[model samples]
Target: MANNFGRVVEVMVSNMLFSMDKYAIEGTIPFDNDLLPNESEIKLWNLSKDTISRIKRNETLMINAGYRGDVGVILHGFVSSVLTKREGVDAVTSIHVLDSQDLSKRKVKDITYAEGTLASYILKQMVGQLGLPIAQFELNQDYRYEEGYTASGEVTDIIGKVAKDCGTSAYINKGKVYIRNLRRGADDVFALSKGTGLIGSSEPFEEEKFKGYRIKSQLQYRITTASVVDLKCKDFEGRVHVRSGTHTFSRTGDFMTDVEAILP
Candidate 1:
């Protein structure tokens, strides 16, 4: 079912985080509506680390919504969240979009969506704009070290030393995204750290912009499902633009089952 796959897709995407090498960061950033649905105009803004391109809502979005009909979103939740971050400093509002309400419950189209959250921002940065080429990045491991004193020659400086971790530089690759780049497209990193299917918010109640964004969450745990059927879509097409999956993803038929599976 769509809802089931929604959860499954979340699971699979989260699963990808551990792999962390699917995409590499580059300096050449490209934006395409075909790869990622729900596209409107883009709002380019400034970031301390890099230049950010935000997708605006009020745009036409057509995915493999289903045989029943199409869902025209102003913008995808990821885009909405970026806008929310820009507009409202620390607040997020969203919805639980039950996929294809008209379809049968036994069918696969049923799905639910909520507003964005901290994790959403992480994923947005990881996925970046769908069509946009990979971006450059700087990676860092969030590890810390401790120092001990025994009245003898002090222990070596091991504080904040991460063994196998590396950061990517955006200026070098011309916006190319490497699996190692944290700020580039590191959505899976946080999810792996957290563990669960992710939910997102479109409108944040409180808005503020600091160096980039710093968040300490006020908690609420609520519940939530597809492959990405053929996702025929429009203008957006290419290798990265092209849909990648097995199990014969299609543009029609049981919409739920089609997009239920996660890519790779």
Candidate 2:
């Protein structure tokens, strides 16, 4: 098991920032940012009455967590709901958030593209309509519609279509949109070994005919969805593509990232 001491967590609600490690008596954040709109929850206990009162729906929420000197933002989304309940002598608040707001459910009116329009251009226009900032926008193949094309339906569906046509994939991370080649992973590649935070032996897995492993490591922000991780261990020694995962932190000594990945 990794040392994983000195846990740190920061929560920003709109302009208010709370150092969870100090202010919160207990909390846990579970996030899975993958294809489709990402949704997660933040639960904190024993927050000050002032802070809890100030939190409201639709406010921007950003969470960062890791060990000391290794922290990074793990989730960025808008508050969907906030509920507080009295448990024993503590007040526990559960805040639900959704990434990209309502963009995934928003319907895109029918838009026609003339022949010779690049697939990337269409994706850009659609994403622009959603008003979210773009982090990375690159496609493996920018297909040109020689016969023109029409786009309609949920914004996410159209994005999926464009990705399929261009042999790419689309997802939202930290409130930013990304459309990239299916075979390619994120820019940072993390190496995992016993010395590098690998928690235990990875278990082999096969899903949809794609073989990979289910891995757990000390909680950190570097291994997110679409991240590339090189595994060096007794059972596995190779690079795997992160498909989906959750970063969890709690006061009960449960700080880890559980990942589902595939060989790529």
Candidate 3:
């Protein structure tokens, strides 16, 4: 009683869709970006001379992976590097890409904040200064800087501090920024049933000394870091907030999303 049940993966460079012939795209997008930036590796086989020349550094990269009725952009970034290798008779190419937020790795000369400011206000000002799009903002706690807080390091580092002060997670994905409240409850987007795309039983795990769950499911792009999921496995039945996840696509267009989440 469904429309479709197969996998479809598409990659676009600089807003132009590219052929998937002998190509594969894969990457992980973290929910909590306090550590690394969103990145991906694209492998192209037997590229034509013209196509090879089209592949350039600094071009924008966009990837959408889905199964059946669910489809959305799962990865987006700038092409960081391109490498060509000859394998016997065919030339293979690998493209490395980095999230848009990677541009914020530079030190922000100076940033001043007023006393008794709302965490959301501080985050808004920070992202505005960096020119990053706002995907979502939920942080509302107030932050008081007795002597005023001044940012003098990497922009990402300063944003990370603001996130910690509000007890939230902040990061950029697909060229959009997200500032989520860790203490707030989220509505379950979808109920993952055991017989419906659920790859395996949800198991309890430990991550960073915090309780978490490891989830494996067929490829779908609607869920991302900060999205709340309701698992209906026989072993576990509750909501878990996604902390990080990996979306992988094969040469045949098959896709999978593996997520690590913590209880809300």
Which one wins by lDDT: 1 or 3? 3
Off by over 4 Å in 3: 1-5, 21-32, 114-118, 182-188, 207-209
Cα lDDT listed for each candidate: 0.19, 0.79, 0.69
Question: Which ranking of candidates, highest TM-score first?
Answer: 2, 3, 1
What's the C-alpha lDDT at position 85 in model 2?
A: 93
Worst 10 residues of 3 by lDDT: 21-30
- Provide the lDDT at 178 for model 3: 76
Residue 7 alpha-carbon offset, candidate 3, angstroms: 2.0
TM-scores for every candidate against the unseen true structure: 0.16, 0.91, 0.86
Candidate 1: tens digits of C-alpha lDDT, residues 128-241? 322234432234442222232111111111101111222221210111222232222423221100112111211112224211111111110110011111111122111111
| RMSD in order of candidates | 23.3, 2.1, 3.0
- C-alpha-based local distance difference test score of model 2: 0.79
Using lDDT as the measure, which candidate wins?
2
Better model by TM-score, 1 or 2? Answer: 2
